[model samples]
Target chain A: MKAAWSAEWLKLRRSRVPWMTVLAISVGAAAGGLFMFISLHPGRAGDLGLLGAKAQLSTLEPSWPSFFGLLAQITAVGGVIIFGITVVWMFGREFADHTAKDLLALPTHRAAIVAAKFAAATVWCLLLAVYLTAAGLGIGLLLGIPGPLTVPVAAAGVGRIFVTAVLTIAITTLFGLAASVGRGYLPGVAVLFAVVFTAQIVAALGYGAWFPFSVPAMHAGLTGADGPSPVGYAAVGAMAFVAVTATIGWWQRADHTG
Target chain B: MAVVQVAGLVKHYGAVKAVDGASLTVAAGEIYALLGLNGAGKTTTIRTLLGMIRPTAGSVRLFGTPVTADARSLWGRVGYLVETPAAYPELTVTENLTLMARLKHLPAAAVGNVVEQLGLRPYAARRARELSLGNQQRLALAKALLGRPELLVLDEPANGLDPAGVTEIRQLLKTLAAQGTTILLSSHILAEVAKLATRIGIIHAGRMVTEIAAADLPHHVARALRVRCHDQDTAARILRQGGYQPLSNLDGMLSMTDERAVWHPDEVATLLVESGCPPVHLAVAEEDLETLFLRLTARGAGA
Candidate 1:
């Protein structure tokens, strides 16, 4: 198991897509910082208040922390998409390049390989999420947020984002596996999109919020003011369960051929 | 003891029998070539042996242990190159082999040595996709040999290769065999198989038609004598009437087989001369693996 994990890690390190995504996230986060600066400028704030002079301009104090939060949210989404794309690429490329035959020929257990890939993707997503969080916080401090940082609140927020990123990564990786081993990308992506969209609609219809697709939104504190539903936790657990089960089924039963 | 044993192995896809009652074995240090055309169940059989697919009906054993369960444990003792070389394209050649080494749990120190031995140092830093098809194959071979597995299963390992590349691979296989690697190579290339295989198993329509050792192959396939002459029809008629079985009439030349008949070059020349058909050439030709393959497959087709 350790060997499989190490092998997967090495492969990920050699790949350029991960680093490229990280770069994109950094750039997007920096741009968000610039946008916040322009929006919070004193001149801009005064001009915006002129049209409706009765509008409360005093409540419009844009703190550096707010900019940090906005950047963090954007970067977080970027990180999720990056991780999702990696999952899809890793799973789909093996079939596309006719390399699955060689992959399955390794002496390691098939289940171990699948688990290792998912673990590697999870670790990558977590690291990216942390980096984005830290970058946001660092930039926030530099731009003159309040002194004496609230480490506990920041840590809690980061932790939730990390969990959300992990759940999303797992779901995407499973979709990749299904796409890779089943047929090709379009079909696999189609199935993934359908499952997620349908789950969202079902949750909206009050069927139940405990679906895998709803976990990330809930974790990000975006689901209505119901305050972090337990459904998100359940969704995480359910996705992890289904991902493992589907991966095992794929490894054991699918024809390991190109 | 046989290094690999498969018995009554069967696998089906929907209604198609991909592998129907296929069974064969490779003994220690022997190179067994599984010969078949496309979709002849060669790949399916290899997959079954590798535990990539569960057999619908049958059993496989490595060494003396049953392989139904705990098949992964058995994989450490075996190496394989299935169809295409499956290394990660994004990884450097060395990285690809190193990853495989890590998977096999080889000692950290030994990984470099194997990579160097496979002559992979030149392309060590080059990503897999950057390497030529031959180098990609070499990387795949390097990975397969990482742990010095006792059994090696190679499926079309020489698919895309120039003559030199083929020779290099052939030498590598020979060296591995010299070190006691029991190899099971599947290919449609008879000449390549003839070069390395100690034993050959011909598969047709998911069934084993013949398992012939290298030494016995010639005897099993009948030898024919070619006689080129003018007035081919007259010579052929005489030969046929004189108890000779004509294999074919090749454009005014005659090819015939007669188990009990001996053709002294001078005697055949005299006979053809007397028959007003002076022979220009007379040569004995032994049947090769290709002919035997055709014959076997044709026989199976008729059945």
Candidate 2:
């Protein structure tokens, strides 16, 4: 497992996609800063035109908590796409590049290789979460949000953002399984879009708390309809367990002739 | 000692039988080649031997250990390259080898050794996408060579190599086998396989049609003695009376495929000379491996 982890991390470190995800999350945080600016001065929104129209879509306040909420919301929503790509790239590249056969018939167990991919993804996604929070803090300080940015406040924000990131990352793993079963980038991306669309429909139908895919967005108060109940988080955990296990089992047992 | 033992291996995908009852035993230090046409189940058989696909029936074992078992350690001594050469296009040649070495639990130094072994040292720092098709193949071979595996399974190992590169790979496999490494490679280049393989197993339409030893290949090849004469009808009857089954060939010549006739063309000449139908031309024509392979595979296809 350690050897697999070393190899997986080396691959992730050299890849451009991980860094691209960071930039994506950073851009999301910067956009959050813009939303906060419009919330502080609503009249300036009209003068800003399209940027203002985009800012007005987010109902934020000039406060640390509102800024944190905005960042979490972006992660909950954008993380599904960005982090899903991270997981998808990790598993799908093997097939897309036709290198999966090499990993099989190796001294290292296939499950170890899968686990190593998940571990590397977890670490990178966690860093993306932390970076998003820090970027939010920097953007807020430069814009001068209303609340004082104390160490405790910052800690609390980090905790909340990390929790949201974790929930989002958990479900992103389903895309990894999809990529494995589908054997390429496009299928995994298709499943991701389906999950995202289904989550929205399920959440809109007022059962968001029960669907695991909708839990993270609800937890982040994407609609301010309601925060997810504890059951929703548990459901997310169950779904994550299933995805990870099924993926490992698929790697171990599935016919890999192609 | 047998290094690879595959018995009654069968793999079926829905209605299509990719491989059926294919069996072979490869002894240690033997360069065995699996010869086949397109879609002859060569790849499927190789994948089953590597445990990438579970057989619908039969068994495959390496070093007396069942390949079907969850024997992770069993692969520590085995190395294989199936199908086309693939690599992480983003990673350099050295990095790609290091990644595989790590997965195999090999020492870091193994990377450099294989790079040198495969003549990839000059391209060590180049990204895989930047290398030519032949160099990419070299990198794949380098990865397979990592850990000094005792058994090597390669499918079309010379796919992208030049003529010189093909010769180099042939010599490398010969040297590797000479040092006690068992190699099982599949190739369509009949001439190359004739030069490299100690034994050849021809698979056609998911069946093992025949297995032939390199030394005995000449005997398997069809040889016919041909005779041309002015009085062809008289010569044919004379050869028939002389205890030879003679048949007329398309190019105005009488030919006999009997082993005795081929072995003693002198007797056929002497008989024709005494029978007033002396031969103008009498020479033995032999089929090459390509033609023999085609005939054998065509026979297997019917079966």
**Predicted complexes: DockQ each:** 0.51, 0.80
Q: What TM-score does candidate 1 reach? A: 0.87
True contacts kept of each: 0.60, 0.85
Model 1: per-residue Cα lDDT over B1-303, one tens digit each: 898898998888889988888889889999999999888899988887876778889887788677642466787888888877766888788777777777777776656876776788888899888988888887887877777889999989887777888888888898989988899999997778888899989888888877889777767777667887666778777767656765556465577666543345455666667767777778877777677788887775566
A145-203 per-residue lDDT for model 2 (tens digits)? 98778888877767778888999999999999999999998889999999999999999
How close is every model to the real structure, measured as TM-score?
Answer: 0.87, 0.97
Off by over 4 Å in 2: A50-58
Q: Which residue pairs overlap in candidate 1's backbone?
A: none
The lDDT, on a scale of 0 to 1, for candidate 2 is: 0.90
lDDT of 1 at B166: 86
Q: Which residue pairs in model 2 clash with each other?
A: none
lDDT of 2 by residue, B151-248 (tens): 99999999999999989999999999999999999987677899999999999888999999998899889999998999999999998888899999
